[model samples]
Target: MAQVLPPLLDYEQSYPCPVCRQGQLDRLILMDAFSCNVCHHIFSVNLSQQSICLADRTPALGWRWARQRWRPLHHPDIDFPLGIWILCGGLTVLPPTILWVMHYIFPPLPDSSANSFPLLWIGVVGITHSLIALWILAEFYQLPLYLSWKFRLQS
Candidate 1:
């Protein structure tokens, strides 16, 4: 069976917000633009191209209206490649594993608290690296936390 592509949305209709994914994009009164109730983002609609772009940002963020959902439009300059994902994963896992292995291979002296394996430090390092990795990935992936701070600063 052949798949049919969704028709472009008319200016009168409401669609899901591409940025927040939680709000409906309602058309603004006396204007051709749309705004999301949740994110409060203004979007410029292009009927000819069948797309909506974030009106306030440079290097415009945009999405095309599919029948059931919005499809994100990609910009090469903003997209991170596979290498960055790999690096993030490494940053999340490598340091903790190395510390664990070192602790196991060179056991701390018994009855000497000062020569302990420093398990708290190991956990701290793991959590810190994991948070850094999560933050980087979230920013690139456009997660809610990153978007909140990003848009907050602009406002």
Candidate 2:
């Protein structure tokens, strides 16, 4: 889904670091740019486009600020967190796959009901695991409503 991001409208605001993803990009004192505290990367801002690019790197790569995170300005097709998606996909698909393989190798008891038991169990477990993985993905992606509510309650 396309996200509506807040403009890098002012330097007074702090943004999440695009490099480290853990630090805030705070405006450097006496400078027209921002620097990430954790990664120590300086970024030059383009107010017109509401994007910021690394000061020492090519300006072709830039990012914009979503409400609680940063979105890449360029390469929209490749902007997701690959590692997280891979991890979540593995978690969701691995266990059921192993279970199915094991079941195939060693068939369940010959009893009529018993034959169906393994299939039912595997289906239930797979659905449960998939739901959990989706939850993890949502949390990691920081869904706006959930994130805002969480912070509000914490405060």
Candidate 3:
């Protein structure tokens, strides 16, 4: 999938932010520490166990880094009404495919050349519908939805 934006937080490297307590402590330009986008406070990283606030660091330990893996995290936006993603994907794929199949399987009769106009119209409509669905999917992808390696951290 094409990623349009970098995430606010890198899950493999961050945890629930201690400073803001809303967003995660996202990794900063430096690898050893993180900064919360919410509070704008930078904190140190404790790679051994959990999110720990060192004496000198800002945000300290709460959720620990226990497990991590990379997968497509569903977008919170379109997920509403649920199964919408599947529906969009289906619409993107199914129409053109069906039209192609029907064209091959049900060719126009030998003397029905003038009647093929409707088939052309259907093909154009299918292509337009497919492009619309694809555009919708692209918008979802561009909406900051990302695949992350999330850790099952404990509080």
Candidate 4:
């Protein structure tokens, strides 16, 4: 006997796979779920007024696929561009070089220059540079995190 197959979704009716991000998502209509053709993962759709997430709680397999890799759900490794480190390195060195050159040209007298070049300047440079680095890293790492969480669903 030939097993009956359900209807397949068309291109427009399908969506990008939430897990692989590379496959098309086709509806498993009879089950009220969705399946990814590429990775063959299943999802339980949860639509609510406040929030809509696939899987809707702890995933059964406890794994997530993102950035072309599979990792543990809660602690997925984030993928970031190499450019973030390059930019951060330049920013880190430029400020200190400028400060050092200025200090070298005008040698602060040991006893009387504390007021002119206060310790507060050091604090300012440190805080500003750290803030920039932290912000860049945060921005670079966020996308991967979002992807991992979004695809965590398992039906």
Candidate 5:
């Protein structure tokens, strides 16, 4: 069956730039502000008041100084990757060592499938440990970006 699609609309109508009155919307650069390539102006749009203001040139030195002074004192959140590495390293080494000792002291029955147990146990533990580590690393990697965005908003 043929499906009819809606007509294409102009970019300006579809996505008007929040900063400029007549400029076509490109992409949102930041919250409350957008850069107009055509006019080479950064406009600030107050969503609450529905007003736009051209960005002014403020000295960025003060912000840099503040960040340098505060960042040192504020302990950034714990890095998940390092934490996971420590956790997984311990998990990977400790269990197998204990299991190995147990196996040596109380050997598995000759007829029992005890011979294969350590290998399977180690494999399962290693895989689970690696998966958990990867998950933690991925979650941790996103923290910095989120923290930066949050700090930016607060400032």
Candidate 6:
């Protein structure tokens, strides 16, 4: 009868530091190694010879809570909606509002074009919509800064 060996575990699958397991790592200081906040231990293990190090061991509980609270607003993956909103609002709303004001200020010419009362109403609607969009955008802009500060404090 031949003796059988158990399967070898991959380094990536194994815990780099015995003190801190994978999920318990508050932050990954390097690709393979992490500092354990619970035990305040810094240890290294071989993970593809990257020479990774773990320096700090403070947990970021406040940062984590803040991130969760402002999750919806701090998405870097999405394009900044405010920039698009401002651009489109300016292009679509300003011209109509100007035209509407001009119509009210100046009397119709003798060889007159038709009255633009309909367009004037549309302009008012556009301006109202743009104002609402701007308010929402202002609220979103603060979120990124909040998250960045939180991360910085954590590290």
The Cα local distance difference test for each model comes to 0.81, 0.77, 0.53, 0.57, 0.47, 0.45
Model 4: worst 10 consecutive residues (lDDT sum):
44-53
Model 3 bad stretches (over 4 Å): 1-89, 142-155
lDDT of candidate 4 at residue 134, scale 0 to 100: 66
Best by lDDT: 1
In candidate 1, residue 111 scores what lDDT? 79
How do the candidates rank by TM-score, highest first? 1, 2, 4, 5, 3, 6
**Residue 17 Cα positional deviation in candidate 1, in Å, after optimal superposition:** 0.7
Structural similarity to truth (TM-score) of each candidate: 0.63, 0.46, 0.31, 0.39, 0.37, 0.25
Q: List the residue pairs that clash in candidate 5.
A: none
Clashing pairs in 4: none
What is the C-alpha lDDT profile of model 1 across 75-132, one tens digit per residue?
4234445877899999989999999889889878887776755687789999999999
Using alpha carbons, what is the TM-score of model 2? 0.46
**Candidate 3 lDDT (Cα, whole model)?**
0.53
Query: What are the per-residue Cα lDDT tens digits for candidate 5 across 18-130?
Result: 22223443435445454554344554444443234455544311111121111111233322356667876786677767777777888777898577887688678767767
In candidate 1, position 105 carries an lDDT of 93
- lDDT string for model 6 (88-136, tens) is 6776677677766766687566565755655656668777767666556
lDDT of 2 at 50: 71
Q: What range of 10 consecutive residues in model 2 has the weakest lDDT sum? A: 2-11
lDDT of 1: 0.81
| Candidate 4, position 82, lDDT | 73
| Predicted structure 6, TM vs. truth | 0.25
TM for candidate 1 is 0.63
Q: Return the clash pairs for model 6, or none.
A: none
Show model 2 residue runs off by greater than 4 Å. 1-80, 148-155
Candidate of highest TM-score: 1
